[model samples]
Target: MSTATSSSDLIGLVLGTLRTERASTARFTLSAPWSLRSDGVEGLLIRVSLGEPYWIEADGAEPVLIQPGDIVLLPQGAPHIVRSARELAPLPFSGLLAQHMSGAHGDHPITFRHGGEGGHGAALTELFSLHLWMPQHRGQSLLSWLPPLIVLRAAEVATTRTLALATQALVDETLTQVPGWQLVTARMADLLLVHVLRAHLQSGAAQAQGWLAGIGDKAIGKALAQMHANPELPWSVASLSRVSHQSRSVFSERFVQRMGTTPMRYLADVRMGIASQQFEQGQADVARVAQDVGYASEKAFSRAFERWAGQTPSQYLKLRTNGAQIRRHKG
Candidate 1:
């Protein structure tokens, strides 16, 4: 499926390639002098602080203070600790998960209280968080461009009203639990995430050499979106440069500088990434996968796939299947 992308498009290609899956939602009510250390799961985490400000310290990163109405996206699932203050020692989140599992009777938000028992606490910090999962390949393309923590501050709400409104709607739906709320909140969560990402991209904060930078660039972003929109198309430097409204030489130089690779090489990587996703699904044969990804011949596709994946197509399939089987047996 090909899409004509423009320089003004935000996250069109990233959203097109990704499949978002909802996981769980929980509201944490904690008294002052509390902290929880959560190990990163294989997914994304969206946190919104409602009642009080808190400190979040992720591994290999500095601590950030989260204020009310602030939306934070842990795109890469980096392990982190959330505390009411900077000096508190954190308790493992597994303990809270275990408690919730033991007491869970329905599909309701998991609730936890810290620093005090029962319901009487003078100062309480309330935080609501939702978990989501995205396909690994596309997730990497998105997350690699993000910092370990992304905060959409409450101050930006005036100019970015849609974001503020989305956050409010998600919180309301999650809290009120109206009919069809599961589906409603799932979509709202998806929209909220997209807006958060778009805001980050437009903020000019992502300076690293990756797809994020490409998306922020005026000329290169359009070409990047087109390549991602149809990785299977036989794309050439000249064709992509035209889409970017630049000559071949200038576009090639800009793309290489921003993305750290030539346009053709980047297209090759996108094709391989799509092929890997298909292989993981196990729904297509080698020949069809090869052709669908723009290779005219299976041998040529196999050679390229191996160079990108360090394994032949068959080997890659077998390994993926074996990994699934092992996981099932373990379960």
Candidate 2:
């Protein structure tokens, strides 16, 4: 395969493991003197404003003014309050949902009306929200690489026509509940997220050395592609440097500068991450996962896995199975 394709495939492989589930979309119609606060949420909460500006006060941060055509991503699901004015008394999001939403938007979004006593007030804010849940195993690491809050302004979105279109489509989709609208909106949401990430990477903000920065660097990007393309290969720094056509010192320095980790450490993380997923999914036994990830000795693999995962392979697998059972029972 071509080098570019391999790098893209590696990125896709990493992101594909993050499956979005239980996505619930909601639109809010709000008037002045209105506010809504959600307690700490466990999953992601994305909000886009399509109308008048509002104030969003997230925990541990100053209140942000979100203007029309602005999108906000709260990846950690931090508790936040959205208000027409900063001093408004906040209403609980749950209570607002109970009061206004009838839960009738099957496969679509539910509309919530806030701060209108008996539906008599003039509404001024139009906000759309999407609550997304990522897979447990890989999702944690994925989130660690991202900031707690990401806001894309109208001007930024305007830079990428595709992103603008996708964002606009989401706003349109929220307003009109047509047939198969859920699927279309979901696809658009995914597209918006991908484009946003790409735009962020292209910008210099994420250049502080991480996977995001590494992916944008040509030499490190090629080396990463090689490592991910064949995790089972017995890869050394020299070999990876050769892939990037750099000397050992040059490659190692550049890799660390871009990825914030050594080539060997990056390879180990990739292998272990893949192995954990395989084990969690019951796709492979302990020995198989170890071997597939390039570990020759099961004992050595178990030791390394323990150091990385905080438990031995067997223990981790058993705990995962029990957790799944508990979740199933709760469901």
Return the top candidate by TM-score: 1
TM-score of every prediction relative to native? 0.77, 0.72
Rate residue 302 of model 2 by lDDT. 92
User: Candidate 1 lDDT, tens digit per residue, 238-277?
Assistant: 9999888999999999998888778988788778777877
Q: Point to the candidate with the largest lDDT.
A: 1
Which TM-score value belongs to model 1? 0.77
Deviation (Å) of 63 in candidate 1? 1.9
Give Cα distance to truth, residue 247, candidate 2, Å: 3.0
lDDT of 1 at 240: 93
Residue 132 lDDT in model 2?
Answer: 68
Clashing pairs in 1: none
TM-score of 2: 0.72
Candidate 2's displacement at residue 316, Å, is 3.8
lDDT of each structure? 0.73, 0.70
**Runs in model 1 lying further than 4 Å from the true structure:** 1-4, 7-10, 102-109, 116-121, 137-141, 159-186, 245-250, 260-262, 276-283, 302-331
